[model samples]
Target: MKYDVAVIGAGPAGAMASKYAALNGAKTLLIEEHASIGSPVQCTGLISKAALTECEISEGSFVLAKMKGAFVYSPGGEELTIRGKDVKAYVIDRKLFDRELVGRSIDTGADLMLKTRFMGLHHGRISVLSSGERKDIHADIVIGADGIMGSVGRAAGLPRCKKFLSGIQFEAPYDACDAQFVEIFTGNKFAPGFFAWAVPFGRMARIGLAKNAGDRPALHYLEELIKHPVLASRYRGSRTEHVVGGIPLGAPERTVKDNVMLVGDAAGQVKPTSGGGVYMGAVCAKIAGEVAARAARKEMDIKEYEKKWRSAVGRELALGMIIHKSLGKLSDENLNEFISFLNRPGMSECITEYGDMDHPSVLLKEMLKGADKMRLVRLLGVAFKTLF
Candidate 1:
């Protein structure tokens, strides 16, 4: 098969890229390795209102819950309630969400190929194993939205994401203080180098943790997470579904080479602080699609994709990385103090005004303006030095 632009993977990024490519006049094809899209779900499925806008979808059957606030717990078990003015995020069914995205891509003139595994690149063509048969497809521009462990970036010789956070979660019956509020738990014994969370949906919640702890696997942290007084009280000691995944944290130095470019997890377009990829991935995927379409017509350089995407989100991603690093290094004592500070008068108001799930740097900047500089110094240690 031949095409003007070929996008690998049928996830949100790949689907969006192919859709935009076709929308911009490029003949496009989107391929998925799985027989069905979004079969084995991996995400915690919590996304900001901005993420939904980026995906161009409104509340649908995929939206299982609407979150209006969060209740954060310190290591010492101090509680901090942050209430938003209105709904701030959503808990989604990823299987339905992904299918909707791919369906949109197909509606926009992008061809779909299921059960196609990308093998490698050959002589400017893509080699794939489709339905137990090896074949090659010709395309002028290739967009790699295949994910972190994907082959497209490797075949293109592009560098990988800086690091990965190990994540584990399970769905279970829950006792939620407020169905509209998500709960955040932080401390060393529970989730060293990261944090744990319980995102509620009516009487159920997605309980999970992500960590940089190497010796202690995600499962180790999970075992302790469920034992927390808050979790133990809410959890019914039973789980219906479990998920394990690695979340890439930072973008590589480069994401484009010759006729190829990377997007989504393959290019590490995820938020370091939140480990969410959909928002950033959708932003970059549109750029990749537009640039790839132009490049296919010999009217633009693929490097334009890199330049534009970075310009759009580079500062946000970089600042988020700085915050993630500082937070990861904090000791239990430090976390208690940090959460305490955030719980202070006026702090919750600031959070309600400025907290953005997709753009945390905005809140950080706003907080630094009102915060006592000396107090910040004591909390963050050396990693805090990079922020200012």
Candidate 2:
């Protein structure tokens, strides 16, 4: 088969990329290894409201719950509530959500190929195993929207993301304090260099954690998490489902090499602070698709994709990385002090006004301008001080 652009993986990034490619007049081919789209769901499915807008999706049946705010817990058990005046995010059903995205791509003139596994790229041709048949597909440009494993990138001799976090999650019944508030846990005991969460949807929640590279497995930390006083009090000890995955952070130096381009997790377009990719991924994928289509027609250089996407999100991603590292290095005692400071009068109001899940850097900037800036500087220390 011959096409102007071939996109591997039918996830959100791939779907969006192919849709834009076709909409831009490219003959786009969207391929997925799974027989059905959105199988073996890997994400916690919590997405910011801006994420839906970025993906060009409205509130659909795939939205299980709308979240207004979050309850954050320190290792020492101090609670800090970041209350949003309006809906801030959504808890979604990934299976239905992903299918909806891919369906949109198909409707936008992109051809869909199920059970198609990308084998390699050779001499500008794509080798694939489709429906038990080996075939070669020719395309002017190949877009890899695959997951962090990045088979397409490896085939194209691209470098990997700088680092990865091990993550695990499960769905279970829980006695929720508030259905509209997601709970966030921070400290070294349960999550080490990362954090754990209980995202409530009705009487149930998705409980999960992501940790930096470590000697102990994520499961070990998960076991400790459920034993925490806060989680133990509400968790019912019954699990309905489970998911395990890796989240990549730190984009590679380049996302494009010759005719091949990478987007989404394949290019490390995820936020280091929250480990969420859909927002940033969608942003980059749109650029990748438009550039790929134009490049395929020889109207633009494939490298334009790299330039455009980074310009859109590079500073935010860099700031997020700095924030992630600063928070990750705090000791449990320091976390308690930090949370206590936030619990002080007048601080919560500031957080409520500027807090954003998709852009923590904005809140950070606001805090740096506050009267308690010195206190924050003392708590966050040298690393974060560099941001100023």
- The lDDT leader among the candidates is 2
Model 2 TM-score (2 dp): 0.98
The Cα RMSD in angstroms, rounded to one decimal, for candidate 2 relative to the true structure is 1.6
Candidate 1 wrong stretches, greater than 4 Å: 381-388
Q: List the residue pairs that clash in candidate 2.
A: none
Worst 10 residues of 2 by lDDT: 379-388
lDDT of 2 by residue, 1-388 (tens): 8999999999999999999999999999999999999988999999999999999999999999999999999999989999999999999999999999999999999999999999999888999999999999998899999988999999999999999999999999999889999999998888988899999998899999999845789999999999989899999899999999999999999889989999999999999999999999999999999999999999999998988999999999998998888787777887889899998887899899999988998898898899999988888784455345
Model 1 C-alpha lDDT per residue in residues 265-311, reported as the tens digit of each score = 99999998888999999999988999999999989988999889999
Task: Give the Å shift of residue 248 in candidate 2.
Answer: 0.3
How many pairs collide in each candidate, listed in order? 0, 0
lDDT of each: 0.90, 0.93
Clashing pairs in 1: none
Alpha carbon deviation, residue 23, candidate 1 (Å): 0.6
Q: Tell me the lDDT of model 2 at 298.
A: 92
Error of 1 at 281 (Å): 0.4
What are the TM-scores, per candidate, against the unseen true structure? 0.97, 0.98
